[model samples]
Target chain A: MKKGKWGLIIFGLVIFIVGVTFPVWYGAGTSAPAPVLDMDTPVIKSMPNKKCVEDTAFIRAHHMKLLDAWRDEAVRDGHREYTAKDGRRFEKSLTGTCLQCHSNKSAFCDRCHNYVGAKPSCFSCHIVPEEVKK
Target chain B: MKLLLPIIALFVVALLAACFAWAEAVSLLTILAYTSFLIFAAGFVYRMMKWAKSPVPFRIPTTCGQEKSLPWIKTHPLENPANAWGAIGRMAGEILLFRSLFRNADVKMIGGRPVYGSAKWLWFFGLMFHGSLLLVALRHLRFFTEPILPFVNGLSALDGFFEIGVPALYLSDAALLAGLTFLFFRRVVLPQVRYISLFTDYFALLLIAAIAMTGLLMRHVYPVDLSAVKTMVAGWLVFAPVVPANAGVMLYLHLGFVFVLLAWLPWSKLIHMGGIFLSPTRNLINNNRSVRHLNPWNPAVKVHTYEEYEDEFRDKMKAAGLPVEKE
Candidate 1:
């Protein structure tokens, strides 16, 4: 049994090395940005206003949750006003409020979302003007 | 092999996870995931190759019931498969439903009397644990695909069909926990099992349980930004990982445990998943009388031919008056 197995282990380890290094053969294409994710999209030169409902870190992590809460507030609970942590208030609607500052979505939204590979379904229901890249 | 190593191994995983959390090093998590999967896939393929390449030198099948013998005697076809097709059917049963584990029966002494009874609870929880784990893994494909496959959506819907909360309660969550708890308790309760249980066995089981618990916590308790998670996963899939700053410590902890599972799989007995199929006792056909099975590793034997023996002992045989063919 030992004699039989040792031969197999030697032959199999060689194959295992080949199998593990498969990324070397097929990973070249995957390493670069995909065609769908156009990496060189135009950048947003400026925003309508510098103030956001939440800070950058919170917005980066909890944007979807905040958006979901905002949607429930506006549509389900009939509350339109959202008071931010810094005493700023904004309307609770994706198209009406969030889109006001980040109107250039191709440059602002698509760039980051595409970079991070996030495809939010907000636009599945709501209509918005396409951002014309400069 | 001992209690200390697995505990220390688990502690190392936990400590590494904490450091990542403290540093907010989400990219490190992504890198860990990539490397973990590479090793897992490679090792899995390697082990499978080894199994496939290994030679079975004898027809040694374990027969659980009456084999094919006299025409008058009834044979149990499923339990003691005699042919290749029968073996296939049996293998299917074993793989899909764990037929061997299902056959467990406990014999015990009760008040100085011998008693035999069914031990099906182990089978039940084992099935539940494995089945729910597969379902949960399948449900997680939502993070990898774009425009979400309808089947994936359908699976998630079915898993969370209860609709109990904001995020919906996945039924597998409860089943997994119940199964793990039952299995763990049984291991602790049974004296024989407790005595034989190694630290690695407990460590693997507890690690998976912790992973499942953390997953439940993330879902029903402190739901993370799934969109952000999807983004990171999609990036990982396409070689463009973007670890979201918002993905909290819980997600990292869960992933850390999974990474450990993947890394330890090839080295551990968990590899029995692939080994069972290659097992000669389970996979071989029980038709030794009907067919000659060659032993590939049969060693050559040194022998004295009858002619040579007769020639060498002829004088002695004649003198001693022993019968000899040549004489």
Candidate 2:
């Protein structure tokens, strides 16, 4: 008995396999080592608490939300002060507050952002600090 | 109730994942993912091969319009394709745009008389659901890709173009939920559909809904470390699987549900995804009139020819005074 349309059948099967198992082939030899974030900035070293506005885990997961909220509050509503969980007050400014300690943008922000391919438009309007230009 | 069973089963599955996640059994989850994927892939291939090997010895294309014939006659190329390319185009239209489903009709009472009217809701929601699912699946390429593909990035940008909410909600996610809601409610609300629905129907829907809900929980309600998620996915893709130290309970639940769906897909009605392509009625070209196709099921038999019959029965026919063709 003749097999039904072997050419079309094989083509369809190949497409299905290639499409479903795309990740395996695409990342076959790729090594996505986690980006090593640097916390050795002069401002970070001089900090008393040596902590961010939130805990490490919270910041790691939701720093984008915090930054977005800060942008809205500071620029739109004129509320520049953020009250942390521990009653510590922080100025809700990315460049002035967050970037002061993480001044080395390439080392601090760019690492994880590049690792995950997140191209946030923070630097579109705001300039990278001149101090950390080199 | 039939509805209650799938919901309860899904809940139990979720609870199982939650317990495992609570115990930090990430390796077990990884193993399950790998095993489920292997089963899904192998089963899918086996099923497709079975379909491929089945002999369809007839040009049984479901023609809906005038077939190609006499020079003066008009023919619908898509509805009744005469050539391979036309058939392919028809398949593309059916697969991508659901051309046939778009022509769905419903019977309803109008002024005490039965009337046939267009019922495009299933087509609409089905397209929405499948389209969004495709996009959502494509969006996950970022997790597996070391350097994310530009097309995936562009797709993500388009999906999250609205920039609503923190973390930027993907429009596909919302559309997927809306589609699922409409589809689920249609089964529950329409008595005709509800009567025909079975356990697997509700199970498939609920399982997907659970996956989506758990994913949303992780994204908005309880944000997980995305970098870790990406790392874990990348690790799996590269064959050096690393269980994230803190993949969170929601991640496991979401991923566990997905693995379950994958494992169940080939063995369930979801195989229609592959079956649609192989369906003879849809894929075959209506060219039986133009070309001869021998049915393979027809068996060859030993034949007694007229000459042989005449030769054998000539003596008997001559003796009985009946006319014989030959001596």
Candidate 3:
């Protein structure tokens, strides 16, 4: 009962220090060059307009939310027409539009997801098409 | 009269959160959220380490049982633990069940007769308050996790089993409010309790109540964009934080109250959260008679040796016919 808690002190410090570096160390597993996320993935570069439904910066910051909102609107609320700022219209479905060009999820989505060690749940329910597999 | 300052303090904090929300101070909120977590965890760990610094130089566990000596006499393992394992069991019981508080009783003169009964309501409400608060925290993990665990989903589902509204009302929310109300009122209604209640005690109750109320209002009345909230949380997880452009005022208020709670935890009586685990009385085994306890703080002092005493006493001993070693 009177003994020093050196075990507890060491344990607490280990958990705290290791936990602090978990996100960075978890994703940075290999020294190999990470794949680039770009518009020139052979599909988007071939399109007439190399633009998404939103501005480039906005899309980068809010693509996940946009996708989530689209899911609720299309699947839950049953309203699907999503108008892009440039007067183009598209169905508010992830698999229908967003994944069409970014069909190579392993390349584009996983590149960022794996790099950040973020496990986005989109692939939990959505499947890769027969022709889309790398 | 004393409660005025804390009340104003609570109002000011609530106002700040609302302001942050309306202004869409996303980056500030992000910074505040992470800073709050770091302060809470670090402060708690620091306090725990501080407790470890003091040496409890005696086996002075609070015991209410016969000592473990005579073979024929029965020993209460829990009340007076003879060893470490028994001490662990006692600590676990106290921590998990609030065993001492459960035994609380208050006598009242009813019809010129002293009445004695279980303070079941006090125990029940206290249990409800802490239990519901824990469950509510667990339910919020949905906003933090990507493929949020099944247990979190299941906990929220169980909490909202009544399904009373658009967002599905949670039983924990209601229980938390009711329990807080009871505790707050008890402090005000009972003269003895009210007399002893400091401003901080009332402030703690009101603060948590406000948090629960504002949280419920956000979920049920003026809802924030939850998907946006989750996205921000996910970004925070990956060290790629982005403040949401449209996260509303209620979220800010709820978060602000949480910030205050985190900052106050290490300094508040609420630190019993960690203290319960470290409490010597509750955690130590009662084995003073069986084992010798040494005080590390007690240092050896210069002393006159028996031989020295005899050497000095030799002249007197020769006159008084006393035995002397030096003589």
Candidate 4:
């Protein structure tokens, strides 16, 4: 018999390396750009402070938690008002208050959600904003 | 000290990574990850090459069934493979199902004669650990992929179907932990097993458990920004690693454990992942009867032929009255 099947062994190793280091070649020359949130909506642009209910960093990280809290408070406890960190009062409604400024759901909401593969069930019951369908 | 040493070492490693992360030493962490990966890849190739270069002088397949013989006799192809196809099938069984280990039994002296009892816990735990590790690794593909694989999403949904918590708990997470725990306890709880257990074994288990715990803490307790996690990991894949502003210490600890495991794998028993395929006893076909196998290391011995011997000593044998065929 031959000393070793070098051809077959090398081929197997190549396959293993390729499979294990898939991300290296898969992401080669590819840039994973973060989703660009368009805050150019007329409602947002018209605001004097030009800010969100919470700070940008806080909202970016804990938006889901905030939305969850809002959902429970509005639905279960019938608490419809929210007091912001900046001592501002706002109605705790997705469509009525939150989406008022962020009117373009696709540009503002769907971008990051799709990028991160977050399948939020918000639209399952609530209707998608009219502008989003356009 | 064997147990305590590795535990302390792992703790120190995690602390080092945590400190680096706190200092926002993104470049250092990236360099560490890359260096460890390089070591793993190099060590893998080195070990494989070493194994390949060493020649096997004989067919030494560890057979458990009857070898091929007369036409009337039956042969177990999987257990005693005589052909390439049979060998491949046997290998598949050994790799996927761990066929040999499945038949494990504990032999004890009950009434002076040996008594064999089922010891399938080892096999079960092995399967659980490997199976759950595979699932967890697959689930992590989402971080590497740009758009994220659709099957990954489906797999995640299936794995987290129980929906025990707010973000939903993954079944693999629990299974992996249980598997690690069982594997660890088996060494300490069983006297025979403990006798053979090395410090490295305990170290590997504890390190893995630590990684899993840190990951769980990030997911359930602290709730770190997953977006940041993905961004950093995906960035590393693309050779553009950026430490996100809000990346937590838990993430660093998890990463530290993973890096250490990667670097240590090729040098440790974990190389069995690759070594399983290269094992001569399991991989070689049982074809000694049908074919000739030359020993590569056999020394060349000078032989004196009968004809040559007779030619040299024919006259002397004839004079001495000894019978000679040549004369």
Clashing pairs in 4: none
**Candidate 2 Cα deviation (angstroms), residue B146:** 1.1
Runs in model 4 lying further than 4 Å from the true structure: A1-4, A69-97, A131-134, B108-113, B305-327
Q: Please give the distance, in angstroms, between residue A111's alpha carbon in candidate 3 and its true position after superposition.
A: 20
User: What is the Å distance of residue B124 in model 4 from its true position?
Assistant: 1.5
Candidate 1 residue-wise lDDT at B268: 77
lDDT of 4 by residue, B1-327 (tens): 767888899989988998988888878889988999999998998988888877777888999998887878999988898888998999898889888879999999998999999899889998899889899989888878887888988998898887666466899999999999999999989988888988899998998899899988877666666677777777888778787767778888888899999999999998898889888898888989888887877899899998999999999989999898866
Q: Indicate which candidate wins on DockQ.
A: 2
**lDDT sort, best first:** 2, 4, 3, 1
All DockQ scores: 0.13, 0.65, 0.07, 0.46
lDDT of 1 by residue, A9-86 (tens): 557566656654443443433543322422232222364455567986677556767887887888898999999998
Task: Residues B73-164, candidate 1: write the lDDT tens digits.
Answer: 99988778877788889888888898898989999999999899989988999999989988987777666555455677778777777655
Candidate 2 stretches greater than 4 Å from native: A1-4, A75-77, A131-134, B307-327
Model 1 chain A weakest lDDT span, ten residues long: A35-44
Using TM-score as the yardstick, the better of models 3 and 4 is 4
Against the reference, the lDDT scores of all candidates come to 0.74, 0.86, 0.76, 0.85
Global Cα lDDT for candidate 4: 0.85
How close to the true structure is residue B46 of candidate 1, measured as C-alpha lDDT? 79
Better of 2 and 4 by DockQ: 2
Q: Report the C-alpha displacement of residue B248, candidate 1, in angstroms.
A: 1.7
